[model samples]
Target: VGMGDSCAPSNNLPYGTAMEANLIQQLTLRGWAVVVTDYEGLGTPGVHTYTVGPSAGRAVLDAARAATRLPEAGLSADTPVGIMGYSQGGQAGSWAAELQGSYAPELKVKGTATGGVPADLLKVADFNNGSYGAGLVFMAAAGQDAAFPELR
Candidate 1:
């Protein structure tokens, strides 16, 4: 249910394409409160760095903080939280978990689940050399550029 750069929780797109609606439905079905984030720059004016993990993590965590303050959510300061993501989102989720120890320690991030993590971009580029999946090389380049501007 993790959204990419061009998508946002507030976008009026179809349910399948919007993480907000999907998360809402799932939370309702399970009787849980859902908190959705538009990431750092998706709905705001700025570059939407798709795979910049720290920015993504901060956006997610800050959105949760904002959600907890809403009267409709009825969430308390002591509520437990967990993180999960896939692909680019896996990077963001991992960053969120790592930051939780220092930056939002009260949020109680019990665990995290990530899949298809691009932990080593250089290796990925070598693996996809000269193939159609070589497009991933470009993606890695963009991600690295956003994550480490000095590398750009």
Candidate 2:
């Protein structure tokens, strides 16, 4: 939710926090299958690639791919996939859906829904520069640097 490996969803006891746990519980209660990704470097090695589109998006789609391939899950390519998220997750989900046509054409994406996406990074940075959320800008910058080491 914030920065660092400690905050990674995978490292959390109930999937990042109470809110995330509750969301997963709600979906599972309705018999809807859900899979959450920790994204690259999160809880694994190196700094998390926080808001970078391609890395997060590829992780989302790849999660779907991994879920459907699970032998015990019984899910298949025929299963309809739906992506949903808010804020950072929203960005990831939307990117996955956008890239699905080429990156994961085989996934049967039924639909996608997102909210509070930081689509315009410059605007978000400007708006939060002097506010309580200002730290987010620095975190995002570090994430960008992590995602594109060559560019840096």
Candidate 3:
């Protein structure tokens, strides 16, 4: 399952509430179960950590763990899994891949597919200067600062 872009207030949009029905249907048809994460605080409380790699990665892994424990889903702890994401989601997926070997060794992650990943926040900041995406760069910086004070 893919992590989505941005966070909407739970009272307004509620995380994962707007997922495309067709996408879920296609995955189910292919015999792949799905579980998407709403990130740290998007569907709950407090501020979302946005691009903080470790936080996003942990959220994805935790979702995987939570999915396996649902008795009705019939998923086991040994179930093999694959992850995919794009844009901001891509970065999160990539981080999940890096973290899984250590953070969640019990999880059987078969593979990860990431697209349009912004791997380097500083590079994104430098490259987007004076460009339309410059605003995104600043937001990334702010998110990093909020999530990790040492980086600030």
Candidate 4:
């Protein structure tokens, strides 16, 4: 499956509202069933951790596992799953791939494709010269701090 920007799965809006509808349509035409997740907390509670890779990855992978149980997916647990994303979605995809070995080993993740990945928030901040993107970098830091207090 593939994820678009933050508006894609992490927010249950229309394809046009989230990402390019044509892209989803084309992927579907290519015999790929796409499943999107609105992350853990979007319109619910707490804050939207923009580039929190681990949280993003867990949401995507768990959503995939949940999809297997849905009649529309028509997939079994043994099915080889692949994840791909760009931008914020890329961070999520990368997290999912990195965590799969220990987090969801039963999912059978075949591979992952991530583009425009923000692997290092500090680096991204430095590259962007601490602009609005730097705020996102800050959000990532908060997420990491929350996920791992020891790292703080």
Candidate 5:
């Protein structure tokens, strides 16, 4: 997913949906319908809640709900779903699985597959403090602060 406003998916900018589009394409190739969501503020009017599991998780589940209700999509609440993601998405997908029961009990989630989840923001920041991904540390910091403003 794009990290900044300049590359938000709603901007219709190139490389906006590059990350998981390939995997989504694979599912489509198999004749399955797919839907995606731009987390809590990634493509909207406020600060992108990057790394915020609850927001991302709710967005993911909500997308599924919306997709199922779309008249043209011909989907229903009974439709099965399998969530998967990598990196930032990995965390979101994992959170979705955890919250699916209480947040969206109607979703028939088959399974969840996630990779490279940032289980601990502190560890992630510390590890990337002086590495090539140093900028990610700052980005994560801004995102975390935005999501948990009381802590700021």
Candidate 6:
């Protein structure tokens, strides 16, 4: 399954970013069914959780759980699962990797591929300040605050 990037709320899954469409099509062509998430709040009411690692990771793993339970999806507990994402989504994928062993031990996750992962958010903040990636840093901060209101 693919974890979609950060995006504005949109209840319609088909209207997701082009990247989501491409991933779904490519995976389907290769004989693999796909599932994706709009994260905690995007495409729903309230603020998105954004970069909160545990929240995002849980959403990804939960999607896999929900998918396996769907009989029409032809997925089983034994079916192999792979997680892929980029940028903000990459950080989420990384969290899922760390969380899978304990949070979703039943899942047969074979692998994970993440690109442009913000391995260290503080580092990202320091580097992106006054740079082109500043917007991303701001979003991350806001997301954290929303998830953990004490931070605000």
**Candidate-wise lDDT, in order:** 0.69, 0.88, 0.76, 0.71, 0.83, 0.80
Write the residue-wise lDDT of candidate 2 on 78-142 in tens digits: 89999998998999998998899999999999999999999999999999999999999998999
Clash tally for model 6: 0
Candidate 3 contains a number of clashing pairs equal to 0
Backbone clashes, candidate 1: 0
Full ranking by lDDT:
2, 5, 6, 3, 4, 1
What are the runs in model 1 whose C-alpha is more than 4 Å off?
1-6, 12-16, 19-24, 128-130, 146-152
Question: lDDT score of model 5?
Answer: 0.83
Q: CA RMSD for every model?
A: 3.3, 1.5, 3.8, 4.1, 2.0, 3.5
Which regions in candidate 4 have their CA more than 4 angstroms from the true location? Answer: 1-12, 130-135, 138-152
Clashing pairs in 6: none
Off by over 4 Å in 3: 1-22, 150-152
Whole-model lDDT, candidate 2? 0.88
Candidate 4 Cα lDDT to native: 0.71
- Top-scoring candidate (lDDT): 2
Which has the better lDDT: candidate 3, or candidate 6? 6
lDDT tens per residue, model 3, 24-48:
6688899887887777755646556
- Choose the strongest candidate by TM-score: 2
Evaluate residue 18 in candidate 3 and report its C-alpha lDDT on the 0 to 100 scale.
48
Candidate 1 residues 125-147, lDDT tens each? 79899997776676556545655
Error of model 3, residue 67, in angstroms: 0.5
Prediction-by-prediction clash tally = 0, 0, 0, 1, 0, 0
